[model samples]
Target chain A: MKKVLFLFVVLFGSCAKLDNNLYNNDNKIKEYKLDDYTGEQDFILDDSYHIPPGLVTLLTLPSQADGESSSTEIKAIYIGDVSKINSDTVLLYCHGNKDHMDFYWQRAKLLAHVNGKNKYGVLMMDYRGYGLSKGKPGEKGMYADVSACMQWLKNNGLNNNRLIIYGFSMGTASACELSANAAPMLPDKIILEAPFASVAVMIQDASQLNMPADYFTDLKIDNAEEIKKCDQPLLWLHGKSDNFLNYKTHGQAVYKNYHGRYKESILIEGADHGQVPSQMGFENYLKLIGSFIRKP
Target chain B: MRLIRFICIFLFLIFICFCSPTQLVKPLQKGQRAAAITYGGPLIKFAGAPIPIPFTTLGFSYGLTSKITGYASLHTTSLIFGNLQTTVGGLFSLYEQENKFGLTVSPAIQTAYNIRNKTGFRIWPTLDLNAYYHPLQKPSFVYIGANSWFELSSLRAHNEPQANHIIPNIHAGYMLVKTKWQHQFEIKYLGLGIPNLPGVVDYIGISHKGALGIYYSLIRKF
Candidate 1:
């Protein structure tokens, strides 16, 4: 009797049909509007209460992959000393699922200020449906947006040797996908923060049960599977106390699967989810990141 | 004692199979029929009191009249090991106006079973009320409703259990087909409890219903 009851509870709890009503509304996509702020005056500090010093420039990258009629726009922030663009290494930062690029502006600034004498450029962009970007955000739309920004960087004379990719949470999947399909030019290094093993694994972890991976979102980008194909140096950072994305299940899986030249894993003791870098103090975290990048 | 246990088991099985508030109503016409079903589990939270328990239910319904309909549903809850409670009831629609407005009333009876004492039976009485609206030209609609239940049996812990609750259901969907067939999705907050566990406590509950079923007439013609 106990066994039967346990089975019943598990069956119902694990696979409750997704509440389609929450997403059925047609108003999921809204036009992006810039928040009122002084021109480049520590916007991140104002928005998220984090103070990092750098020259922040707002840029828009147009997406033409969806044909001439497509009006999709990609909103991005370029952070660094604008005068030293020709010699500085560029970091393309991709944020997690919840908010827009503005949420990570402070982090980008810290990345730029890591090696003070040696300048670095950091560019963070909003996926479609987030912030000032156009249209609803989905798997295909996000890939197009990132590709457009990469092309924009290439056109402006930034090449593989001077380019680094940093992705967090959902953006880690995008970073891995791009790295696997890199053109003749590839990124110098890839950093994943709070990365997941794969889409199927994430869904199963969230549901707390076994669900058929095939029935999930039609576009499946398995980062764990894709990371094996890339030879780039990979860095993964995760917090041990993260309850939302279990460290052992998602983060550990990626670390175990990456068969690359150089792979580094940092497990913060008390950090939770997106709080690792911030909790460690910006300067100390920046120093660690700088040493990792400049290591021979 | 053995005979009494057999009779109780047979009656309980009959209640599980037949008695319910949301059930399919046979249509009067031949082409298509429209019906609605509603079922809820036991209250997990009661104001400052929180109880860790398992409560669940399943309801299926079919349409009978073009504007007027009928339904039946079943509710089951497990308060403790070896003691499972169940409620069975049926409902009828008084009137409906071309999906514009509707009024319905339901009556039900509930029973409890003790696995240790298979011969015991306890029954109770329940009532429910509903009102629904859908504009002819607009893509928006609303439904306001309520329900009550009263225990009729003389069990130590089961006497005169009364509940008064309300439901406000709203829907917005493009008419994929004319009145006969339309793809519809609805968001409803069925407020099922009073100030102190009066109905069913549902502050953190939200229901989203979407269906791709066809709507046809039975008795009443346009």
Candidate 2:
């Protein structure tokens, strides 16, 4: 009876699943709007947050050919001088689930001004299947895609201590995954903004049922668990009223689970999933992030 | 346990993709037994194609007295996903007159335990209220009713206050009764009067509030 029951559970558990391909909106990109590109933005920046004419460079990164992830080329935008990457404190910005890099350009440009305009470098990439990248998006592909850009940064002079990974919304998965696993290399520090706890948490919260995520998806992303394995200094920020990924359930879980070297939490009131920076006041946001990096 | 405002954002779960319609609209005769198989759920746009999530169930009911009927059913689809989902309830005839209008209420407890995760044991108190009209002397009835599934846990993953406590659904059905067999066809508007907007299922709802669910049942009496 035990054997039969176990077999039944296994069969039933794997019976149905929502197609994994539906998760990515990669094909939704019209064009990569950097500066002059005006559609909709997080916030229209004053000339202060602008990246000078030639500072932003677009490049294609090569992801590692590992069994867990597909080998693919990735599109990334670097916002700083390539010649000074060795000495600069570079921040790798992992974007949320949305169209492409263009939608996140305003956020990226704002980060470039952290501490001061172009005080440090920043790199943003559209994971595979997003933007002009190749191949389909998968859970493993997300981390591997970020690793590709990391490889680019490493080959061009960025290293462990100077590398900071920042994730927002869906981007937090790859950021926390890569940092926890420390596969390509370890980051000096990590920042998560409005990070969801896990696929199970999202589905359960969304449905208001005790639904196991495996019932609908095969994706096994768990930032709450992943953060525990990370030993680097962490800065976690979330909006108090984040409607999309409720901070209390998602971000708070990740924040509390971090047994890292150090950690900080910033909960801004009335901000939503994508409005943390604007809600914190760009300067205060940058100051908070900049101070966290400069600490110890 | 804190009661938080619930929003049915995930529209596809119903067709609760858990609450269907009233299984026993009218109490069976004393000492009678019946079994049923049901299928169909909310219509969702998947890959640009409208698909009715095929939620299935197998249920059995027995009448203890002329005025009361008891039932229990397993959600076959949920089981396939390693979630043991079942609802057990008793149907009570509230108001009745032979071959005329009748009101019945089935208050059931919906239970789900995840065998795969080995966690997520949840029991929801559910109520189904229906008023039916026996339009024909040949044993057929048309009914309209409302269903509510109450979430017992006021907290969800990460100790967050569960926003949704009572999930509401409205349905209409027609039952055809024969001597040995019966069939029921029900159409449910799950999550009624709630703003289930920014939908995940692309639910075919009214004013972006709720999903349209259709159910079919076949019952054999013994």
Candidate 3:
């Protein structure tokens, strides 16, 4: 027993903690490169949705993980007049994994045009460790960062009934989590684009083996299960042929699990993980989202 | 999920290597006993460069009869991280032409259980057939074989119907025998006829189909 214990210690002594940052791609970039960026992109705006440089305001909000002092400041960008946020219908756009805010700026800008350009105020933020945000990124920190953003809007006059939360890819966890159990303010509705089912699904899909979900220590971002607890309306959009996260196993699974107030899903044919918006057509995309958000 | 990257590596290893690389294709004499250890996994671009996952396993083999060998192994790499896994099997010699060539079949079962996730026991049935040649007429030889595993559970994430059931691998290897030790090297084309791209792991495969795997083994005889 002593020898076995020694062997166990020696073998796992170097194993690192499963930090929440493992689920995010914040370490992939050293700085934020917005429109000037030229890398892999799912949606590219050809200046049609472009707002003047001053139109989008970059603001830093103080936020922290659950239980810790909320001192970490995160970067957020907003479209429309800040003075009118309290009276505005705001769309909180959470981005996918990879790089920083610049990668999803086009997507956020696209959401700003959901019901005609600049009609609904759109706010998107870089969770800690993403873009110019301080500290590192993790699951709890994600919720806190979003709560801080919503708090800022509430302080400026926005009400819960006019707030909509949207998540893409990795951002889906925060979206579903916050909506399922929001602290400062609950979103009126939730929108998920290319959302995954859960960590269990991802492991089983990639491996074809039924590795126990508990084997993954700290990584517990399960949107499929969390959506079940969400009573708010949900709008799910997924590509028919998503290679990263399969539509049949991931998106459909999440869509089917949500027993919410109101729910609808769109399966875009010939589209993969990152091609949902482009393949769905920008006009149709905006119309679908606008109609859903505009609905009772 | 970076953890998905870890799980994918483990899954890739299941198709390529739940046992030792020296699945010799030749049965040992009655009363013969040996111990073995193996290392290596499907190559992936981890932390920037291409490298094997360094999965490790320790195994023991015993000749129950002249034509039947019993073997079992533990995936120590996984055990170190809290998941306990083992593969158990028997080698049945089907045919042999003295020392020139021989055929053998190994039917195995792999089971894994996590200490934290108690009751979450998972099992997969595996089978391998190898045909080996003794080129030097001594203890050194080469072999080629096909290995496969069956995923019995029909439910995937969120109870989705599991579409895929069997994963196949084609492998070839060489073993060098010494007085009391043996050294082996093997290469496998894992998940044969299956596409292996658009994933977190950059598997080294052929035409984007199936992953190429390399393994090394050391064995001690008693």
Q: Which stretches of candidate 1 lie over 4 Å from their true place?
A: A1-54, A65-71, A81-83, A183-185, B1-222
Clash pairs (backbone) in predicted model 2 = A12-B80, B5-B163, B6-B163, B6-B164, B13-B17, B14-B17, B16-B19
User: How well does each candidate superpose onto the true structure, as a TM-score?
Assistant: 0.52, 0.77, 0.89
Assess each model's interface with DockQ, reporting 2 decimals per model: 0.02, 0.26, 0.36
Model 3 stretches with alpha carbons more than 4 Å out? A9-21, A27-33, A38-40, B1-24, B45-51, B116-119, B195-199, B206-209
Candidate 3 C-alpha lDDT tens digits along A136-159? 877788888888898888988999
lDDT of 2 by residue, A1-296 (tens): 99986776678875655434335354555567777767556777888677787999999888754684546888999999999999999999999877678878999999998888898899999988887887777777878889888888888988899999999988999899999986766889999999989877867755666556665556888999999899999999998877678777788889988897899999998887688999999989999999998988
Write the number of the candidate with greater DockQ, choosing between 1 and 2: 2
Docking class of 2: acceptable
DockQ, candidate no. 1: 0.02
Worst 10 residues of 3 chain B by lDDT: B12-21
Q: lDDT tens string, model 1, B57-81?
A: 4333333444333333334322222
The deviation in Å at residue B136 for candidate 3 is 5.3
Query: How close to the true structure is residue B193 of candidate 2, measured as C-alpha lDDT?
Result: 68
lDDT of 1 by residue, A126-163 (tens): 87777677777676677677777787677777878788
lDDT of each: 0.52, 0.80, 0.78
- Candidate 2: segments with Cα more than 4 A from true spot: A1-15, A19-22, A28-33, A36-41, A44-48, A65-70, B1-10, B13-18, B29-90, B101-103, B107-125, B129-155, B159-222
By TM-score rank, best first, the candidates go 3, 2, 1
